[model samples]
Target: MNVETQKVKIFMQKHDNQKRALISILQDIQAEFNYLPKEALQDVAKTLEIPLIHIIGVATFYRSFSLEPRGKHQATVCTGTACHVRGGPKILDEFERKLGVEAGHTTEDRQFTLETVACLGCCAIGPVVVVDNEYFAHTSIREVGSILKKYRKKEKDNE
Candidate 1:
């Protein structure tokens, strides 16, 4: 038995294994692993007696779900109309440059995952950045280093 198998067993025990709870099950799996590991998905399919394709479809259909391993910290730059005009693209570029990964890729160290969002409804503070669920309003390219530095320090501390 591997680590993923153990995690799947733990999560499967939380639910009744009914197909109706497929989404819920997937959520639990994602929450546990930060993404859906292929082994975990297989466990889910076997447990629920559902086809792997259906499970994969549900995971892929939801933007909130990540099929790949995600970093410990998630950083999202809002690229909506208001944010774009306010140099959101520049901010995003700064993040990519500092992190050495594209918008949709995680850092090699798995410390951070960078992403862009269409809107966060905080147009009043265009060019917003959300990191690990905390919103940073009125973000600027200059602030990217400081923001990333903070999370990097956090990762080091946890180590």
Candidate 2:
């Protein structure tokens, strides 16, 4: 079997007989695979006896769910009022400068997906960045490199 099939199999076992856990189950499955591949969603619908439209509906309704390809690392910069006043735009510029990708785009290497979110509710930690769901609060210009270091893979050309 292919790697994708194996992933679907593994995810299926995690569900509670595929009845009521579609949202959470699919969420977890999406977390594992980066994005919900069409085949994976179809497999889920087929196995759960849920319609494909139903699956799409659930997936699209939730902002956390991404239906397209996502990078290995997800970086969400806060663009709320507090963050904006606290040099959030500069921080975003630095990210785009360093990563070669703007918000809502992925790095060419597929190592990072950059996005902006509104109000993470940690206003005190203005200019916050959440990477792979782990919030890095009270951010500054110098810290961006250190955060990127944690997620970037070693490239052969560099080695």
Candidate 3:
């Protein structure tokens, strides 16, 4: 409906007019829009000669893709066996409370995406939380709030 949304559709069209390329095109659109806009998905379906329902199905099926718009910062807490044993769940809970969103959800303001990763392969950093891909090892309830502030765009105090 808006100009940017229209541009999203046009970009999805440029990838190639193939229905099978939906997943990759959707990923590209998400990379540009910060999340998959519903309008963009519809456009991809229309331009690629694919069924809109099928596109929706693919988008919903993948955990790596989100149907809703995501925040600028993504906060992922490791939930691997090692991390879980080391209080990862509690750390995740703290993040949920502080950010006002549960894992697998984004903040209403779209400033943060809270998530849990099965493993980050950082076993030694078991209780790790990553903010925008920067690892924070040995995380604690006392440490999460301060760590979050560092990634926030509005954090003058953190600066």
Scored by TM-score, the top model is: 1
Q: Output the worst ten-in-a-row residue range by lDDT, candidate 3.
A: 150-159
- The sequence of per-residue lDDT tens digits that candidate 2 reaches over residues 35-142 is 888888888888888889999998988877888788877899898999999988899999999999989888888879999988989999788999988989889989
Candidate 2 CA-lDDT value: 0.85
lDDT agreement with native, every candidate: 0.90, 0.85, 0.84
Best by lDDT: 1
- Give the CA lDDT, 0 to 100, for residue 80 in model 1: 95
Each prediction's TM-score versus the true structure:
0.94, 0.77, 0.89
Task: Identify the runs in model 2 with alpha carbons over 4 angstroms from their true place.
Answer: 1-3, 13-16, 133-137, 141-146, 149-159
Q: Could you tell me the C-alpha RMSD of candidate 2 in Å?
A: 3.3
- Give the TM-score (vs. native) of candidate 1: 0.94
Write the residue-wise lDDT of candidate 1 on 29-93 in tens digits: 88988999988999889989999999999999998899999998999999999999999999998
What TM-score does candidate 2 get on C-alpha atoms? 0.77
Per residue, candidate 3 scores C-alpha lDDT tens digits across 1-159 of 888767766766676566666777877877888777887877777777788898889888987788888888888999999999999999999999998888989899888899999998988977989888789999899998789877674555556
C-alpha lDDT (0 to 100) for residue 61 of candidate 1 = 96
For model 1 the local lDDT of residue 33 reads 86
